[model samples]
Target: MPFPLYLLAMAVFAMGTSEFMLAGLLPDIASGLDITVGTAGMLTPAFAIGMIVGAPLVAALARNWPSRSSLLGFILVFSAAHAVGAMTTSFPVLFATRVVAALANAGFLAVALTTAATLVSPDKKGRALAVLLSGTTVATIAGVPGGSVLGTLLGWRATFWAVAALCLPAALGILKGIPAGRVKEEATGGPALRTELAQLTRPRLLLVMLLGALVNAATFGSFTFLAPVVTDTAGLGELWISVALVLFGAGSFVGVTVAGRLSDQRPALVLAVGGPLLLIGWPALAILADKPVALLCLVFVQGALSFALGSTLITRVLYEAAEAPTMAGSYATAALNVGAAVGPLIAATTLSTTVGDLGPLWASGLLVAVALLIALPLRAVIAAGRSTEVLP
Candidate 1:
C-alpha cells in the first residue's frame, strides 16, 4: 500500500470510530446531560441527516480546493467538534457537534473516494477504494468495540478525547504523504455546481446510487436490532451482543475485501450470485431467531452478503458517475447514509405488529428483495460501465 493510502485509512478509522462509537456512549452522555436516552438518541440521526444533506453540498463547495488542503481542513473540523463535544455539558451543544462532525466526515468520505481513485491505476481503482472503505469495517471490528470498552473503563468523554487524539497522527501523515497541489479541475475552476448536479441526474448514476442505498437499508435495518435480537429473540445474555457485533464486523471486513478483489473484473456477476444468497439469508435469520448459535452464525453470513453487495454497488457508482469524480463519491456517501437513516424507521414500524424481534430481519429481507429487483435490470449497465459504454 502507498504511504498516502495508509494515511487516508487512518483518518477514515478515526472518523468511523467517532461516528459509530456514539451508540455505546449514548447512555453515559444522556445521564451526564440530564436527558433521556431517547433524546440522546436523536444525535445519531442528526449526524445521519448531516451526512445525507451535507455530502453533496460540501463536495460541491470544496470542488475547487486542493485535495490535500480539503482533506486536512476536514480533519481539523472533525477534531474540533469532538473536542468541543467532549467538554460540553449541554445536550444541544453535543447534538450540534455531532452534526458538525458528520458534515466533516461526509466531506472526507466523498473526497477520499476520489483521492483514492486518483492514487492508483484504472484497473486498481476498485482495490484502492476498498482499502479506504476497509478502514470503516475495521472500525466496526475494533474501533467501536474499543470505544465501548474505553467508555466503560473511563468515561464517555474520554472516548471523545481519544477520537480527537487519533487525528493528530492522521493530520501529520496527510501533510507529509499527500502531494500538495491543486487538481486539474481546481485549476480550471471546476464545473459549476449545476454540472455536478447534472451528473447525478443521469439515469445510470441514479440507479447505482439507489442500489447502494437499498443495500445499506437492509444492512443497517437488521444490524440496528442485533442486540435486541440476541437478548430477546435468541434468549442470550448481553455478552452475546458483543459476540454478534464481532461476527458481523468480521464477516463484513472479509466480504469487502472479496468485493474489492473481484469488483473491477466481475461486479455484475457477483451481484447475480450474491444477491439471491443475501435474499435467502435474511429469512433464515428470522426463522432461526430463537436458536442462539444458529442466529449468531447467520448474522455473520448476513454481514458478508450485504457488504459484498454494498461495496460492489459503491464501486459501480464511481464508474457510472465518472463525469464528476468527487461528486460521484458524494452521491455514494449520501445514498448509503440515506439508507442508514431510513432502514430503522421501516423496521421500527414492524414492531407494533406480531413480528417483534423478527421485524428487523423481515424488513431487511424486503429491502434486499427490492434491491434485487432493481439490480436485476442493471447488470448490463454495470458491465457496460467498465468500458465507458452506457447503454441506451
Candidate 2:
C-alpha cells in the first residue's frame, strides 16, 4: 500500500501491455509489413525467448546497481524500444524491437520483484508481489482490448507510441518514489556468485520452477484462443468474448489477493487446491463448451485458480532462493516465459487438428495434471526441510 508499490505496478502494467497487446495487433502488423500473419505471430515467441534469456543475465549484470537505477534504466530502454518500433516499417525491424523491449521487460520485472521484496517486511512479501502482478491481470482485461481497438481506429503503430508514452510516467515514478539504494541481501553466506548460480540446479528449486512453467502452459494453452473458443464452441456472440475476458481478469485479481494473504502461511495448500481446480475446470470446460453460462463460470474459476497457484509458486521460489533474490526473481520470470512460449504453440497445433477448438481444453487439463504430479512431491520436500529449519 506504499506509493512506490503503485509505481512498480504501473511499470509492470506498461510492460505487460506491450507483451500481450501484440496478440491483438498481429493482423494489423502483418498487413502493414506485407508479411503473413504467421510471420507476425513469430514476434510473440521472439519476445518470450528474449525474456527467458535476458532476465537472469540482466540480474547478474546489474547485481551491484542500485535498485532505483536499475529499474529506471530498464524501463527507459523499454520505452525507447517501443518508440523505435512505432517508426519501423519493416517486419524484421519490428521483430527486433520486440526482442529489445522484452529484454528490458525482463530486467524491469526482475528488479521490481527484488525491490518490492526488499522494501517490505518478510511477512509482507507475498502481498507486495500480488499488488505488482495485478498490473498484468488488469492489462489483460483492459490494455489488450484497448490496444486492439485503438489500433483498429488509429493504427497499430499508434498503440506502440501510446505504450512508449506510458513508460515515461512509470520511469518517473521509479525515480521519485523508490529508494535510491541497493536492496539489502539476506545474510545466508554462500561460496560466491558461481556457487549461488549453481543453486539453480538443486532438485527442489528446479521442481518449483518446473511447476511454475507447467501451470503457465496449462492456463495459456486454452487462454490464447479464448475469443474463438467462446464464440465457436460456447455459442456466444463476439460481444461476450470481451465480457468473458473481463470476468476472467476479475477472478484473477481476486485470486492473487487471496493467495498473497495465505501464501506465507499455507503455500503448499494453496498450490494443492489450485492445481486440482485447473485440472477439473479445463475438462469441464471441454464438456460444457456449448453451455454459455457454464463456459463463463468455468473461465472465471480457471483464471482464479491459475493465479492462486502462480502467486504461491512465486512465493515458494523466493523462499527457496532467499540468498539470491535477484536471480531467483529472474529465474521465475524465465520459467513463466518458457511456459508462455510453449503453451500457445501446443494450443495452435490442437486447434488445427480434428479435435477442433475443444482440444485446447483437454490439452490444458493434461498439462495441469502433470504439474500437479510434479508438485505433489514438493509437500514432502518442504516438510522434511521444515523439520530441520524454519522457512520464511
Candidate 3:
C-alpha cells in the first residue's frame, strides 16, 4: 500500500502500546503514586470508557472537519496527554490523563479507519485495515512486553515518556502523509451529522456490530484471564504465562494477515470455515484446560480464529454502513470497544462461581455460539454480496 498507511500504523502502535502497556505498569504506577494497585487498575476501565464514548462522540463532533486536521489534532492531544501524565505526581491527574489520551486515541482510530479504507481501492479495504490493525497485534507482541520491561528497568514515568516520544514521528507522519484540505465528509459524500448518527440504528449494521462485539467478547474474555488459565488451570508456572501470551499474539498476527488478504475475496468462505472452528474451539479449550500441552496449543488456535472473525465483522460494518462513511468507522470502533469493556467484566463474574478459572472459557463458548446463531440468518446476505468475488 500507500506510504501513509504505514504512518497510520505507526501512530496506532503508539496508541495501542499506551492502551495495553498499562497492564504491566499498574503496579509500578500504584507504588509510585502511593495508591493501591486496585486504584491503578481503574485506569484500564477509564480508558475503555473513554474509547467507548469517544469513538462515536468525537467522530460525530468532528464529522465535518478535514481529515488531515482532525487526525493531526488527535495525535497532538494524545502526545500532550502522555507528557502531562508522565510529569504528574497525583494519581487523579494520571487517571485524568489516561482518559484524555484514550479519547484522542479513540478519535484518531475512528478517523484513521475511514482514512485507511479511503486510501485504497474498494476491493483492497481489507488489506488496508489489516495493515492498520497489525500495529495493535504488534503492540501486543512487542510494545506491551517492552513497555513492561522498560518500566521495570526505569520507572513507569519513563514508559509514558517513551510513548510520548514515539508519537512525535507519528505526528510528523500524519502531517507529511495525509494530504492537506481533504474534508473527510466531502471526500466520501457523507451526510449531515444527524444522518450519520442514524446509521448506528440500522438493523443490519446493528446486528453486524453485535456479532463483532461478541467475537471480541470471546477474544478479550479468554485473553484477559489467560494467565490464570495457563498457571492455575493448566498447571503451569509463571514463566509459561509470557510464553502463552506470545504464542497467542503470534497467532493473532498470522490471523489478521490472512484475513486481510482473503476477507474481501472470499468472506463467505471465511465465515463458513472460520466461524465453526471458532465456535468449537472454546469448549475444547475449556475441556482441555487441565492438559498443559493441549491448553497452550489451543490458545494459539483460538487467537487466530477469533481475530479472523472479528476483523471480518469490521469489514462488514463498513459495508453495511456505506451511507455513513464517517460514522462507519465509529460504529466499528465502538463495537470493538463495547466488547473490550463488557467482556472482561462478564468474564470476571464467572470467577466467583464454582467454575473458577475455567469459567471464562465456557463464557466465551456461549458468546461464540450465540454470535454464530446470529450469523445463521445472515449467511445468505453474506454470500449474496460476493457473487462476482466468491458467491458467483
Candidate lDDT scores, in order, read: 0.85, 0.82, 0.86
Best by lDDT: 3
In candidate 3, stretches whose alpha carbon ends up further than 4 angstroms from where it belongs are 187-189, 382-392
Cα lDDT tens digits for candidate 3, 1-392: 99999999999999988988887788899999999999999999999999999999999888888899999999999999999999999999999998999899999999999888889887877788889988888888888778888998999999999999999999999899898976677635658777877877777778889998999988998788888888888889977877787788778888889988877777777788999999899999999989999987898898889888888888877777777878888888999999988888888899999989989988998899999998898786653342234321
Writing each residue's lDDT as its tens digit, candidate 2 over 149-208 gives 899899999999999998999889889999875553523432356766987978777877
* Candidate 2 residue pairs in clash (backbone atoms < 3 Å): none
Give the clash count for each candidate. 0, 0, 1
Give each prediction's root-mean-square deviation over alpha carbons. Answer: 1.5, 2.4, 2.2
Instruction: List runs of model 2 lying over 4 Å from the truth.
Output: 184-191, 382-392
Q: Model 2: what TM-score?
A: 0.94
What lDDT score goes with residue 70 in model 2?
A: 87
Candidate 3, residue 366: how far the Cα is off, in Å: 1.2
The clash number for model 1 is 0
TM-score of 3: 0.95
Residue 222's C-alpha lDDT in candidate 2? 82
TM-score of each: 0.96, 0.94, 0.95
Return the top candidate by TM-score.
1
